[model samples]
Structure formats: structure tokens, C-alpha cells
Target chain A: MDLSPIWLTLKLAAITTSLLFIVGLPIAWWLSKGRSFFKTIVEAIITMPLVLPPSVLGFYLLLAFSPQHGLGKLLQDTFDTQFVFSFKGLVLASFIYSMPFMTGPIKSALQQLPVSLTQASYALGKTQWQTFKSVLVPNIKPSLLTAIVLTFAHTLGEFGVVLMIGGNIPGVTRVASIAVYDSVERMDYAAANTYSLILFSITFVMVISVFVFNKYQAKSPLE
Target chain B: MIDLSIEKRLKAYRGQQILKISHQFTTGSITKIYGPSGAGKTTLLKTIAGLVYPEKGKIVVDSQTWLDTDNNINLPPQKRMPGFVFQDYALFPNMSVLAHLQYATNDMEWIKRLLLLGKLDTLTDHKPIHLSGGQQQRLAVLRALAIKPKLILMDEPFSALDPDMKTELIAELKLLFKELAATVLIVSHNPQELEGLTDGDLYIP
Candidate 1:
């Protein structure tokens, strides 16, 4: 059985999880502050992926970045990048598909923190950025780890979105999930079973690690 | 001298109650703020520390305009640094006792002094989660003073301490506050808790 698909899947999951972490942190922090009409709308849009069908998101993403018209045309004309059937397209799709997993836990943990933690930091002459980096982020380590692992595992399991946007290109767009589907269609049961078993084990380990870490984190009086 | 006049709308158990106060604090003086429950005692401390925004107010601290709502000049909490010992301690669970003071200031000697004052020198490596209630309270007070702030706002700093420990700590803090020339505003339900330490008193009715 070919192993390129497994490597590609790992690469995609790593990149997607890292990018989402950098981008999702500030968004989650902003959303946790309080509720406004604008924040509600933004959160709704971000959370839509969890409820919306993957096929629908994939279809829209393909059309929007088809390199034929609209945003796709704009990108094609300026940066000369195609995001429809490339590895880049898969990353973009994974971003939209797995975003809620990354932000949900983080946002809730941030909201759960006592307001006095922030006030105490500010009272010590620390700026808002300092307070967030030193006080807020450190306190939410367990939740952050959970978010990262869940996002990684979710990206690894993505099939419908990848199938729609990233077609079966041997070394480029064909991830482990897509490879498993391809093997079944060609009557390659052995290869399909191998891919399925690998994904199952990896995801199992990641999820179990999250539960263990959370349980081990010491409980605080303030929490 | 700190001159403060502020009005804020508070959500009380009964309904809406307006917290109105106009007072001046002499430099290096310790003032005890006593009031009944839901009298906005904590709110008043937060407002002075710039943690809470008053609807209409002016806070002039030692000739510095900390807040002037009419003039639209309000310094952020970072700009108006004040040592605040929260009622709940608000200690960082992830940081050790030493780390808390180090975060507030780079003065190693000051940190050592504060550790001794709070009698937490041996537990410098312990996190808040590992400390007892009284130990956590002392850490909170020590962390606040780590910055050696000109203004100190404490909300029941000795609530968890035993009577003997409370008395001893208060006496040490009184001398330290005088040495640092820090103005202190303490809120407590029990007036006798701070009996002789405070030179002035502000009663909110």
C-alpha cells in the first residue's frame, strides 16, 4: 500500500492546526469578552461549519475560488495562485471545516476565567497584551491543548470537503481518508483497511491524551 | 493628595442604586472604608484603580489627572498602576509564589523583603493551588506590594488570617506603607479588623 497519502495527511493536519491556532486565538479572545450584535454574527458564521453539511461548504469554496470568476479570478489575476484542486485548496477547506473545534474550547475556557485575574494584572501596570499573554493564556493551557488536539484529529478525518475541493492527485491532494475511499472503489480491501486502522489509532491516541491531560491539571480555588 | 468625586450606577439585589462619593485621601495615610453589604465598597476601590469606569468622576492623584470624565481624559489601568489585593485573592494558579512577585517588579531585594513580610519565604516555589487559604491570601497581598505602588487598594486583605497572624502582618504593613509613602484604602465589613492601623475612616451609607 502507498504511504504518501498518510504523510500528506499529517502535513496538512500540522499546517492547518498551526495556522488556525495563530488566527483563532485572537478571534476566540475577542468573542469571549462579551456579546455584541457584530460578535454574534461573526461567531455564527464561524460555527456554521459544525452544523452545515461538508459538501455544501466544499461546493461553495470550490465555486468561490475556482480561478474562473469572483474571488478566484481576483486571486488568479494578482497572486497567480489556484485554490480549487491544489494542496493549498485542501488547507483552506480544512481551515473552514475544523475552525469550530479550534475556537470552541478556547473561547469557553477564556470566558470561564475570573474577571479579577485580568484586573489584577492591569493593577500591576501590565498592559492588555501582557495580561493576555502571561495571565490568560497560561491559565487555559489544558483547554488550549484540547483545542489543538481536537483540531488536528478533525483535520485528519476530513473526507467530504477534501473529496470535493481536492481531487485524487496521487502525491498532492490525496490524503489518507481520500486514499481509503479510492482503495475501496478499486476493490483494494487490504489497503483500505490499513488506512482506516491507522487513522483510527491516531485519532484515538489524540483524544485520549486530551482527556488525561485535562484530568491531571490541578483544580484551583478560583476556578 | 488624591481627590476623587465619582457617581456610578450599581445593580443591587433590590434594584438600581447609585453609588455616590466625594472624598480626598491624604498621601501616606491609611483609610479604612466601611459600609454595609451591597454599599459598593469594592466598586469604589476598583474605580480608583481604573478597573471600573465611573459615569461621572474626576480622580486627581498627586497632581496627576488619572480620570476626568468631563474632559474625556481617562487613564487606563496600566497607566494608573495601583496595588490591589482582591477579596478572592486572584492568585495565578500556574505561577509560583516567587513568579508572582517577579512579574510585578524586577527588584530582587524588594521581592525578598515582601516574601519575608508575608512569611511565605519557604513556599516561594509553591503554586497557589498548593498553598492553604491563609497562605494564598498572604501571597495575594505580597504580589500586590511587589510593584511598590504609590496607591494600594485592598479588599479584606486579612479575612482568611488568624487573629495573631492578622495583627502581626498589619503592624509590618503599617511600617512598610509609611516607608514607601503609599496611600491605602481597605474595605472590610468588620471595623475592628483594622482597628488602630487606619488613621482615617470613610463610612458609606
Candidate 2:
């Protein structure tokens, strides 16, 4: 069996998860703490991908990533990088598709935390960033772990959006899900089963570990 | 000295009322803030600490203008850096007793002394969940004092402690407050608890 698709899928998941963490931390923190009128609108927009049909999001992203469009044209002109049918395009599409998976748990975790914890840190002369890093992050470790695992697994299994945006370009964008689809289309049941088994095993382990870790955290005195 | 004249519109079940207060507290003094429930006692302390904003007010702390609504110069809480002990003892669940104090200050000797003052030296490695109510309250107070802040605001700081523990802790705190020359404002429902420790009183109606 060709392992290129598996390697590509892993690379995409790793990159997307890392990017989501860097970008999602502040967004989740704001959604948890901010009281602005625009917060509702922003939250709705972020969560839209979760409810919308994957085909619909993929279709729109395809247009937005077209070189003729505003965002796509701006990137093309500024950096001379074509987003359509490229690895970069797939990364951007996956990031959007998996955003809520990344941010929802984090935001809820932060909201569930007592406001006094952050306030106490502030009163102790710690800056907002310092408090977030030292106090808020450590306390919400379980939720953060949940967020990371969910986003990675969700991105790894994405099908419709990856199809529309990434167009099955062999090593470039032919990730595991797309590889499974290709195998089935070619009537290669053995190849399809091989890919499916691996995906299922990995995801099962990740989800089970998350639950075990959560149970351990619950039993621990500190958490 | 800390001087403040503030007015905040508070929404109550009955209706809306303005909490208007003007006062000055001398340096190295302990003031007890006594008031009925819904009288804005906690709000007053929060405003001083820059946690809550007063609609109209000027707060001067140690000759420095911390808040001036007229001038639009309100400092944030980190800059104010006044030690605040929440009514619920907002100890971090992930941090041990020693970690809580260490988060506020890097001075090892100060942390050691603070642990002794709170009688938590033995439980330095314990988290708040493992601590009893009185131990948690004492940890909160010790964490606040760890910063050696010039101004300290405590809301119901002794509600959980037993009488013997309260008496012992208060006596030691009185000496510690003097040594640091800190101004303290304590809000308590039972005014009798702080009768001997407090040098001044502010009744909020």
C-alpha cells in the first residue's frame, strides 16, 4: 500500500492543529471574557462551519480561494502564492472547517473557570498574558487536551471540504480520507479496508485516551 | 493615604440606587467596611482595586491618581496591584499552597515566613481542593500578603476560620500589617469579628 497519503494526512493534521492552537487561544479567551456587542456575531461566524453542510463550506471556500476573488487575488498579488489546488489552500480550508472543534472546548473551559482566578492574578501584578499562560492554561489542561485531539482527528477525517478545495492531487492533497475514496472508486476493497482500519484505530485510541485522562484528572486532588 | 470619591448606579431588585461615597484612609491603618447586603460593599472594594469601574469618581492612592473620571485616567488592575482576597477564597486549583505564594512573589524567605504565618508550612505541597475551609481562607490571606502590597482589600476574609484560628491569625496579621506599613480594608458581615483589629469604620447604607 502507498503510504504517501498517510504521511500527507499526518502532516496536514499536525500543521493545522498547531496553527489552530496559536490562533484559537486568543479567540477562545476573548469569546470567554469579552462583552462586546460584536462578540455574538463573531461567535456565530466561527461556529457556522459546524452546522453548515461541508459541501456548502467547501463550495464557498473554493470561490474565495479562486485567484479571481478578492482574498485569493490579494494573496496572489502580494505573495505570488496560488491558494487554489495547493497544500496552502488545503491548510486554510481545514483550519476553517475545524475551528469550532478547536475553540469551542477551550472557550467553554475558560468560561467555566472562576473569574476570581484571573482577578487574583491581576491583583498580584501579573500581566494578562502572564496570567493566561501561568494560571489559566495550566488549570484548563484537560479541556485544552480535548480541543487539540478533537481538532486533529476532525481535520484528519475531513472529506467533502478537502475534496472541493484540494482536488485529490496525489502527494500534494491526496490525504488519507481522499485516498480511501480513491480506493473505493477503483473497487479496491482491500486498500480501502487497510486505510479505514488505520484511521479507526488511531481515532479510537485518541478519544479513549482523552476520556481516561479526564477521569484521572477528576480523581486527582488538584483538578 | 488612599482617597476616593465615587458614585456608581447599582441595579437592585427594588430599583436603581446610586452608591455615593467619599473617604480617605490613612497609611498603615485597617478600616472595616460594614454594610447590609446589596449595599455595594464589595463593589466599593472592587472599584478601589480597579476591578469595577465607578461611573463618576476620582481615586487617589498614596498621592498617585489611580482613577480620575474627569481626566479619563483610570488605571487597570495590574498597575494598581492592590492585594484582594475574594469572598470565596479564589485559590487556584492547580497550584499548591507554596505555588500560590510563589506566583505572587519570588522571595523564598518571604514565602517561607508567609507559610508559617498562615500555619500552612506543613501543607505547602497541598492543593486547595485537599485543604479544609479554614486552611483555604488562610492560604488566600497569605497569598495576598505575599505581594507585600501597600493596599490590601479583603472581602469576608475570616468567614471560614474558627474563633481560635481567627484570633491567632488576626493577631499575627496585625503585626505583619504594621511591619509592611500596609493600608487594609476588610469587609465583613460580622463587624464584631474585626472590632479590635480595625482602627476605623465605614458604614455603607
Candidate 3:
């Protein structure tokens, strides 16, 4: 089995996880603080990808980014780029697919915070961003870390969205899951075993590490 | 100088009617609002500080109108410079007591003096959630004092303490408030704690 697909999956998860932190943190903050009747509706929309079938999302994305479409045309005209059937397209799909995994922990964590914390920061003459950085975010470090780890892990296991839009191109769009599927389809059990075993061990280690490390940290006096 | 007459209805569970009352909190003086629980005491403080908006009323602080119904002016909470402390002692849990003091001002000597005055020297690196109830209350008072605002609003400031702790904090707060001469509005439901702790009158529900 080619390890390139495994490497690409890791790269995609890392980049998407990093970018989602920047986008999702403020949104989670706003939802945590702002009051509105439409809060549920807005929240539903962000987490829509969680319930929406990945095939449907991939179908829509393929249409929107097919180079002949409007968004594709605009991107091509402006940046001389095409997105359909590419690694970037897979990454974008995974980002959308895994957004709720990031937002869920963050929103719940932030919602549990006391208003007095923000009030104290405001009373101390700190700006909203300053307060978020110095007070709110730091206090919610465990949640933020959860968001990162969950999003990355979920993105790593992504299959349907990557398969539909990625077209299973070798090394470029052939992520580990897709490669496993390809090996299975071609009756190559050995290759499939190699890729599947690695994916399983990596995922197992990640999840176990999260639980073990959290337990260790909890037991340590430094925590 | 802060002048505010706030009124807002907060419908709590079991039909308890909590309202921000229309009463003048005198400017440039320590005017206490003494009320029982669910009497809208905390709401009044929040409304005066612009943390909560009154459905209809006005708040004039230092000659600058913060919230007025007829004039249609309601400033946000951040723009209003009021040092407020809640019942739970609203110190940032992520910050040390020293950082909390530093967030308010940068005068190290003044901070050290304030720390010594409040006897918070040993608790400098402690977070709010980790501190004892009395220590947290003292920290809250010091945090407000550090801001040096024109006015301060405290909701049941000394409620979470033993008698001795309460007496000590009240004494320290009185000295500091008298020294700075900053206007203060403290809510108190504890009548016994109010007798010697407050130098001002009460607004009972």
C-alpha cells in the first residue's frame, strides 16, 4: 500500500483543523453570548452537515465547484485555480463535514461559563477580543483541545465526501479510506490489510491517548 | 457622578416578579439598595451598569446619559465605566489575583500597596475559583478599587463570608471607598451585616 494517501489524510486533517479553530471560535463565542430567537435556527444550520447525507453534500459541492459552474468560474478567473476532484476540494468537503464536531464541544463549554467572568473582564476595562483571549478562551482550553482532536479525528475517518468528490486520484485525492476501498474493489486483500491496519491503529491510539492523557492530567498535581 | 432610575421586568420561575425599580440612586455618594432575594436588586445593578437594559427608564452617569427612554439613548455595558462585583465574586478564573489587578491598572507600587492594604499579598497568584470565599470577596473589592471608576455597583458583596470575614472586608472596603471617595451602590439582604458595614441608607423592596 502506498503511504502517500495516509500522509495526505494527515495533512488535510491538520490544515482543516487549524483553520476551523479561527473560524469557529468567534462564532461559538457569539452564540454563547448573543441572545436571539433565531439562535436554534442558526445553530441548526451550522450543524446541518452532521445530519445531511455526505453524498448529498458532495453532490452539491461538485456542482458548485465543477469549473464550469459560477463559483468555479469566479475562482478560475480570479485565482487561476480549479477545485473539482482535487485534494483542496476533499479538504473543503471534510471541513464542512467536520464543522459540527468542532463547534459542539466549544459551544457547550462556552455556554457553561458564568456571565460574571465576562462582566469582570469588561469591568476591568478590557475589550471584547482581549477578554476572549485572556479570560474566556484560556478557561475553556479543555474544550478547545477537544474540538481540535475530535475534528481532526473525524476528518481522518471521512469516507463518503472524499469518495464522491475526490474521484480516487492517486496520491492527490486518494486518501487512506479511499485507498482502502480501492484495494478492496480490486481484490487486493494484502494492500487493503496494510492500509486498514494502519488507519485502525492510528485511530485507536488517538482515542486512547485522549482518554489516557486526560486521566493522567487529571491525576497530576500540576493540573 | 452616576444618576439612574431603572425599571425592567424579569419573569422568573414560579411567577416571581423581579423588576428594576424607578428610584434615583444618588450621584457621588454611597447609596445602598437593601432588598431580599428576587427583589430585582442584582437586576438594578446590572441595569445601572448598562449590563442589562431597562424596558423604560433613564440612567445618567457623570452628566453623560447612558440610558434614557424618551431621549432614546441606551449605551452598551462596555462603554459605561462602572466597576461591578456580583454575589459570586466575579473574578476571571483564568487569571491570577495579580493579573486581575494588573488588568485594571499598571501602577505596580499602587498595586502592591493595594495588595498590602487588602492583605492579599499571599493570595496574589491564586485564581478566583481556588480562593476562599472571604479571599474572593476581598479580591473583588480590590478589583473594583483598582479600576478607580466614578461609581461601583456591588450585588451582595459581603454575603459569602463568615461574620469575622464579613466585618474585616466591610472595614477594608469602607476605608478604601472613603479614601478614593468613589460613589458606591451595594446590595444587601443581610440586615445584621448592613448595620456597621454600610455608611449610607438603604432602598428596601
Candidate that would win on lDDT:
1
Instruction: Write down the C-alpha DockQ for each prediction.
Output: 0.90, 0.88, 0.67
Q: Which candidate is the best by TM-score?
A: 1
Candidate 3 wrong stretches, greater than 4 Å: A37-39, A216-223, B14-20
DockQ winner between 2 and 3, please give it.
2
Q: What ranking emerges by lDDT with the best candidate at the front?
A: 1, 2, 3
lDDT of 2 by residue, B1-205 (tens): 8999999999887989889999999999999999899999999999999999899999998889999999999999999998899998889999999999989999999999999999999999999999999999999999999999999999999999999999999999999999989999999999889978999999999
Task: Write the residue-wise lDDT of candidate 1 on B77-163 in tens digits.
Answer: 998889999999999888999999999999999999999999999999999989999999999999999998899999999999999
Kindly list the per-residue Cα lDDT of model 1 for residues A1-223, writing each as its tens digit.
Answer: 6999999999999999999999999999999997999999999999999999899999999999989899999999999999988999999999999999999989989999999999999999898899999999999998899889989999999998998999899999999999999999999999999999999999988877777777876652112
> Which residue pairs show collisions in model 2?
none
Regions more than 4 Å wrong, model 1: A218-223
Report how far residue B50 has shifted in candidate 2, in Å. Answer: 0.8
lDDT of 3 at A202: 85
Give fnat (model 3): 0.68
i-RMSD of all predictions: 0.6, 0.7, 1.4
Per-residue lDDT of B88 in model 3? 84
Q: Of the pair 1 and 2, which is ahead by TM-score?
A: 1
| Ranked candidates, highest DockQ first | 1, 2, 3
lDDT of 2 by residue, A24-72 (tens): 9899998999677799999999999999998898899989879886988
